[model samples]
Target: MELITNLPVLAAILATFLLAGLVKGVIGLGLPTIAMGLLGMVIAPAEAAALLVLPSLVTNIWQLMDGPKLGPLLRRLAPMQVAVAVGTLLGLWAGLLPGKGGATAGLGAALLAYAAFGLLPLRLPQVPPRAEAWAGPLVGLLTGLVTAATGVFVLPAVPYLQALGLERDRLVQALGISFTVSTLGLAAGLASGGGFGGGALGGSVLALLPALAGMALGGRLRGLVSASTFRRCFFLGLLILGAHLLWQGLH
Candidate 1:
């Protein structure tokens, strides 16, 4: 990959992944979101997406296996996972993904929405047990579409997950499960679009080192920092980044 050969870009990639992983380690999420948003400013979103696959997949898998309630979570969330895969593939088929030039705007829109959602004190109604059947698939489908377009998968999915009223540990595990599926779906979509070649895959593998390192560092620092304050700063940064990307795309 030219990105690997280019010293400056390679450095950027390493730094970005390190920071992204740190965020995830501290907050239990935001690796993809932070990585994609930052990298998109420096490269094509498609390339950024390609480089995200391995680190995201590996981390999410680690996260997914950490909790003991996998069986029950899978049973409850299986339909949503399937729908996520289908919707991602369908979005790719419809050419809604990043390489198309319009995707920067799509990504910007997604970031703006996500950051706003995080920053706002919006309370979503709790989803009843009976509503899971219909609600899960619907949210998954929407999340998949956003993922396909932006290479970031935290929108309706996160909001919907929060509304499910799961216990704290179960909620974290559920996020891991959902993100793992989304990452896989995104990988499939990227491969089909010729974006996930050997070079990209290699870069992704290399990127994992920094990501893991950052996660470790962040894990140690988690107790030292206030999560709520850090999260506010994170969302503010995303809001600014989103505005810049939106302007860049429009021009």
Candidate 2:
């Protein structure tokens, strides 16, 4: 309590998590992306990454278990999952370079890329099954590297999953599988970098409460709210937030 009593930071962290969890509850994605993007405004991307470790892991694990097909999903995604972990370690190596603004700038660039991808609605041509054999691992690698660097893991990964031609429900479950693996990889990356030596654990735990509450609220709203409308609002909001983070990081 004493540590988080500092009003500004605590308020910011809690608000970020609540908002993020609401987005996830409604759209089934964007927890880390929203949390990290918003938190980066008040803290470094690295510290924000550290703070998200626990909540991301917990939420993703819940999602991963919600379906009965976990065994097949795990087996199918094994290559991509392994590549993601490797890429995360590689990105952590780059994140270790001593610099003033590089990590922030990198995070900003990632935000810009993500925002652009979202706003434009660009859909890649679906890859043939043979291609996925290679493309899956490649996309996972890129997603993992980005996750390690900016604490946001959506980039090529989400788009890649979308292109998989799975049914809607299966797609959602696939996201859970990908996110669960990615969260674990992120924890390892941050741990290796000494990002959790201080009060990050307490902060993350405190933030989790609001996140879960917001998810419950958003879950209820899902029946009442138009998802497409909410998604439009969400992405537009992310566009604005991403722009702000980019500006802050560079200037």
Candidate 3:
């Protein structure tokens, strides 16, 4: 891929992934969000998505395995995951995945919404235990559509998960599980669309190195920083990036 061959682009990719991984390490999320928001500026959204697959998949898998409640979580979330896969493939077949021009605007909108959710004092209604049967699938389906369009899947899904009233550790693990599935769904969609060829796959693998390193560093720094303060700054950054992309797309 040109991204790998071009020194400047490669450097940007490495640095972007490193920063993204650091965020994920400290906060337990944001790898795909940060990577997509930054890399989307330098590359096509599809190419950015392709480059994101491996690092996201690997890191999320690590997160998923860290908790002891995997079995229970999977049993609770299985339906949602199935819907995520189905919705992603359906979105691909429907050609909802962004192409050149429209994709930028769509990605920008997704990022803006996600950032706003984080920055706002929004309180979603708690999900009653009985509601999971339907709510889970609905949220998953919407998340898959967003993932297909923007390669970032933290909209209704994140909110929905939060509403489920899981314990802190369980919630984190659930997020990992959901994100892992979303990444796989996205990978399949990209591959079917011919966006995940060997070059893109190779670039993604290469990107993993810096991402992992950044995660290690972020893990070490987590103890020294106030998470709430860092989170505020992170959302603010996303807000600016999202606005820029939105403006660029509109023009």
User: What clash count goes with each model?
Assistant: 0, 0, 0
Candidate 1 vs 2: which has more lDDT = 1
Per-residue CA lDDT of model 1 for 65-183, tens digit only, reads: 98886998999999988888888888877887775767888778888988999999997999999999999999999988888888888887888998999887788788899999999
lDDT of each: 0.89, 0.77, 0.88
lDDT of the structure predicted as candidate 3: 0.88
Tens-digit per-residue lDDT, 130-153, candidate 3: 999999999889888878877887
By TM-score rank, best first, the candidates go 1, 3, 2
RMSD of 3: 1.1
* Clash pairs, model 1 backbone: none
Single out the weakest 10-residue window by summed lDDT for candidate 2.
95-104
**Which candidate leads in lDDT?**
1
